[model samples]
Target: MNEINNILYITGAGVSEESGIPTFRGKDGFWKIGSKNYTPQEMATRRMYKENPEQFLSWYYKRFAAYRNHGPNKVHHWLANKNLITQNIDGLDGKAGNQNYIAIHGRLDQMTLFHTQGDNVATQQAPWDSVDETSLTESLLEVFKISLSTRKPMKSQSFKPYVLLFDEYYTELYRISEAQQRMIDADKIIFMGTSFSVNITQMALEIAVTQNKPIEVVDPYPVRIPYENTTYHRMKASEYIERAD
Candidate 1:
């Protein structure tokens, strides 16, 4: 019998591309297609949320909420039973039934108290559960406790999307410590569909390099990492999973 290695799968937007979601850096990726008035970097920040709550929430709702009904794809199902830390916030991993996977970037389908990072606050299902697409904007404003007239977040009643913004650092809210420990403990680390643009990927790569763990990258056009033990598989995530099966 082949010994099962404790492999850790770290995924990114590419994993969900097959599920009809765009990658953050792809030609049609979310970050690449920011709002008309602002760049994604500007729109997806804590500053935007605080200063221009309406525009921030409107942009978020239009881009992210549209994919709320998308189901998990083959890659998500394949990684469902494996140890995984995903940077995608689509919640497809959870939809695929991966009960314990860590969403290092946070989830779009959830919400938390509108507090700063490191605050130990509980999360709940996003208000989208109760509102349809047409009413999402008003519902969002209501749930986040933003005053409809003043367009400012109300204290204590405000909730934010459970996503990590560009201006924010990793904290307990996103399970950063747990993800680091998993990177250390895994015998092998598999990076799927990520462009190596995010800090989480860099953090995992550093851990893998320091521990001398084997690294495998799966992407149609994989980025070249300056690591000795890293292997690159130039294939789409679904194709890679099919070959593995």
Candidate 2:
């Protein structure tokens, strides 16, 4: 294989699975373990946050908070120096010292004001440490700036998780424009550990197809794309890195 230049690596949950983070789509994944009254699809949405804040916060805290400290694996370390756009909210790529990568799906360790996208709001570090699961509801309410007495989010005071909810669209908050520009400028696009289910992957693939750029998919069971210059690496992300090295 020739040395590929201007390569943009678009990663997904599969990349973080090696670091003991759940892909959230497997049979035992987080999405499969929804709350008593809601499915994961329903629970992970803006509607849920607005209508049932307690359940939403509780579910998010239980599932995503536990993996907040997972260290990056070899794949993350290898991709650290490369042009990258990861779909993971785990924030492991940043942990691996990749300062320039885009986390298109937002991040678990961050929070923003409860405002719509493209609203030019600022984000801050989430106060996960202040939460106690024993008093999960109240703790989340306090940390997220919700009112305990009314069980409603305080206007302008309440905050939302940095994650891109199910019903939310990509916006400047997630750096969607920069990511799209990266896709357009790349000479080659490599998708690692992704199932090609999300919009970002599809967007990248479309760009690659239209621009006639080489495409690579790395996974244990790679999804085949019908492009002329596409390649498939049927292996784990770490395995692919080792082979490349």
Candidate 3:
């Protein structure tokens, strides 16, 4: 039997595609909101969030709603025991009871205070959860109005979804140093459901290639595998995991 002790599994949006959640980058990903000129990328930035909190909240809330009902699939369950690193923010891995994983991108279920000073604080859940979405929106708007009326900027701001924006640095919250070390230490590396489009994926791939580690790539679509010791499986994440087991 092949020893899977030093295995490292790096996953992306493709892992959760089998579930109801949609990928947020490709053709199947979040495009533009209705009648909005800005793309999802533009909306999901610190600048946009600061300039127009209402619009930012609207888009973010929609994203949270979309991924709320979906649970982890076979891939997540199988990889729960493996050393996994995920770029997804849906939190399905956590829901599946997979603790041996790192979420490079922050999860949606968490909230953070929009502190004016340095370092925004993160909370397990939203500060005010008793109110429904509509009521929440209205309350935020009222707070904004109050701030404007009293000319007190402090009253306007509250919490924002704890997700990594496009412009944000991964090292801010993610265990990037630890993740990179894991990539370098892995004897066998597996790439699943990723397109090799993100920076972190590229970094991991380069590490594996430079060290001549054996690699297995699982994706239904054609993905670029630059390493010589790589075996590509043109299958979905769940199918590949099941077959390998």
Candidate 4:
């Protein structure tokens, strides 16, 4: 039996940040006092968008801008081949050449939505990440109300960032279904960089921890998962792969 046929992997922002992407929270990663500290849940929820379209759009656009020109780093490229799963929106894990992974948080490399009115809007960027500067222009940029007098920013695909924002249920349920099956089917799960923020992480951790799957977590500053006999390596994703390679 292929020991890893049932192998499941999950990742979080810590892994993506290694590739030069900016995360909502940094290791030393928070805006200082007096600055707006929008909780990830608050800023990333569907309710925020419904109540404040302008703010949501503006914040998302700026947030999306951080990923331009970045490519998957060594860790992402390596783990992509491990029958992986990730919560990152950066799309780097798959682009890094991991063939069997899914982006649980949704992908920034594509944009989409299923409107209540039955409108399904979507745009795909192939051979590159949807976060690529060109993808934004070709797909999503026009929704912004900008003037032609000054050069306008390229549009992201017309749909949202393809991410699962708060108040959004469809993608969340879909991702959870797949992940649950993966967890149930797998004998081992290697979790890297996820902060247990969403239901996905929480659920997977609950299952894996309960099942006593051999799990490993890798990070420069690894958290202490309060479980007996789980291994944690304190190192950057790149460093881990370099040694493993």
Candidate 5:
């Protein structure tokens, strides 16, 4: 347990399945991929957000079923109880009892959208219809939280996916924070469940290795990808949870 303090955890979809979200990439025999399934980049992009906001929101909200069907599980619960950085935004980390953490890609429970640079928004929810204000970044923290806590679509505020989409630059990218930088610069990085599909996030891993840090890659399959200095573990996420106290 003491070793975890030196840890930087980068979790992906696999870590979330225990909470009931389906990842079409992993082979648990649950979700089958089809030609119709939109490439994550296509479905979750700024262009889509503008061209078809409702469709984008629908795909995202339905996938983020944890908002309604499930809660945090042993792994997320365990991470919250610890002091490690994570890459998930399923809100399980919060439910797991951890309040302070960095979401490298973004979060599903928060909302961010394109508004005129200086315009103010009130909340981040799905099927967001509000036009004058449509981003979570523009609102106060208290007001934003209230916007997500309810189910009704408001006449004044809109709620969009809190998760950063394919082509959208993060609000943090313009000015990187210290804690986020530290998490990226850890002595040991542990990756769980995510297939390294996106180039931007993959860049972070590249940065970590370039700095001479060692990485431990954990997944159900041991298939190797590029980049040296990574240790691999072939095991299901649930397998570890089964043994945890």
Candidate 6:
């Protein structure tokens, strides 16, 4: 461990699984909405939010509220000492006091008022801290002055979840360049709880493969996509961390 510096941990929803926050692609997946059959990609789009702000906000806020009660697990705490690039929006890493990490996918605990210019864009809040559904609905109605039937914004003034929606590009992400550079610079790349299905994981893995660096993956199952020079540990993320000695 002493020889390791510039550590890059490419993390996914599995890291937070021990904390009782479900993985995004698990059986009860992010897109596993009820009978509506709307996928997470559909629900988390800007268009969905615009078409029916109330319904969109309700879905997002409810999920955010569920995440609020869960604190980070041991794996998150262990990762605090490393340079992390996480695909999770649950904000567990931040809650674990891992300030050195980059949340490439955005975070649920934070939000910003969109359409604000310059310095005003920085005004952010933990939606669960002060946002109430009733007040949010009232505010959307007041700000947009849209008819109930149409549900379209007359004038656009809205709060944006500090996350990358399905339609959003990595350019819209915060610190994406920094995250990429860290991935490139790291001599050691460790992956935890990722299924290799998302773009971020693909990017990280590609860099590792190109660099010919050794890869350590901690997951109970085999990695979804195999890579050369990778050592796999068959255990949950927290278990792997605890047994790292």
Best by lDDT: 2
**Arrange candidates by lDDT, highest first: which order?**
2, 1, 6, 3, 4, 5
lDDT of each: 0.89, 0.91, 0.73, 0.62, 0.57, 0.73
- Scored by lDDT, model 5 comes in at 0.57
Question: Candidate 3 — which pairs collide?
Answer: none
C-alpha lDDT of residue 244 in model 4: 66
Show the colliding residue pairs in model 1. none
**Lowest-sum lDDT 10-residue window in model 3:** 147-156
Model 6 Cα lDDT, one tens digit per residue, 1-245: 46766668889888888888777777886656522546667778777766776666657766555677788888888888778899898888888888878988878777665542222245365546555456776544443344566666433345666777776667534677898899899988889988887788888889988998778888888575567688888888878877884
Model 2 vs. true fold: TM: 0.97
Candidate 5's TM-score reads 0.69
User: What TM-score, computed on C-alpha atoms, does each candidate reach?
Assistant: 0.95, 0.97, 0.85, 0.75, 0.69, 0.85
- Once superposed on the true structure, which residue ranges of model 5 sit more than 4 Å away at CA? 1-4, 27-40, 65-67, 83-85, 112-159, 173-180, 223-228, 241-245
Tens digits of per-residue lDDT, candidate 1, 1-245, equal: 55648999999999999899988987888988888799999999989998888789889988897799999998899999999999999999999999999999899899887886787898898877665557766776876778889887754578888899999999998999999999999999999999999999999999999989899999989999999899999999899888899
Report, for all candidates in order, the number of backbone clashes: 0, 0, 0, 12, 3, 0
Displacement of the residue 210 alpha carbon in candidate 1, Å: 0.8
Best model number under TM-score: 2
> Residue 82 of model 2: what lDDT?
92
Instruction: Please provide, for model 5 over 52-142, each residue's C-alpha lDDT reduced to its tens digit, 9 standing for 90 to 100.
Output: 5544555554455325436877778767755454556666777778876666555655564435322454434533233223343223322
User: What lDDT, from 0 to 1, does candidate 4 have?
Assistant: 0.62
